[model samples]
Target: MTKHLSTPLANSMGIQDQVSFHRTELAIILSLYGRMVAAGEWRDYGISALKNLAVFSVYRRTAEVPMYRIEKRPKLRLQQGQYSVVGMDGKVLRRGRDLKQVLRVLERKLIRAVD
Candidate 1:
């Protein structure tokens, strides 16, 4: 006798049901990541795609907690804007409808790192 397996809830919902970064969004994030890596201010990173939000986390070391979290929440798109950069302490450094604008907070740190 063969046993039937049930599908996972996520699989049944399909890919579109989850939030994720688009190519253009990744491009922008990567550009900043690359620069930060080269500056030696950031040593590692992680990405997470969840039901309501997507996140790109930057770390100073592989084992350490992420120094920052860049999040995109579609539900917040109509409210507090869709993009945000959160500090290690979980405080929002910046939030805006424009990803570029929201990411400037990190860029400012990069500039300081170089100095």
Candidate 2:
């Protein structure tokens, strides 16, 4: 069996009362990715789980900056809300405590006119 290294948060920060993505985060992010792919709006994506944050970045092309970044920061869980959707310019489209609500910002992009 392999041993896992402990981090500062695990050894010191202890249990945080703040909310996080949990399992549903993956489902929500993946669902959005699928729709964006089908719409031909997104070509690539990346996920990052940092010490204090988690980021889901959507890219139209590999070299260019991500078109959108869905981030989860537990430290800002209460102050700015845990979930946030940011645009390419790093502009926050939405931030809230509810994951579903925070994700709604992206869902709006999926809407199209019946032409």
Which one wins on TM-score?
Answer: 1
TM-scores of all models? 0.84, 0.79
Compare the candidates by lDDT and give the number of the best one. 1
**Candidate 2 deviant stretches above 4 angstroms:** 1-21
Candidate 2 per-residue lDDT, tens place, 50-86, comes to 7678888999999989999999998787798988999
In model 2, pairs of residues that clash are none
How well does candidate 2 score on lDDT at residue 64? 87
Cα lDDT of candidate 2 equals 0.85
What CA RMSD would you report for each candidate?
6.8, 6.2
In candidate 2, position 100 carries an lDDT of 83
Model 1 C-alpha RMSD vs. true structure (Å) is: 6.8
lDDT of 2 at 45: 92
lDDT of 1 by residue, 1-115 (tens): 9675655775677735679999999999999999999989998999999989999999999999999999999999999999999999999999999999999999987655333
> What is the Å distance of residue 42 in model 2 from its true position?
0.8
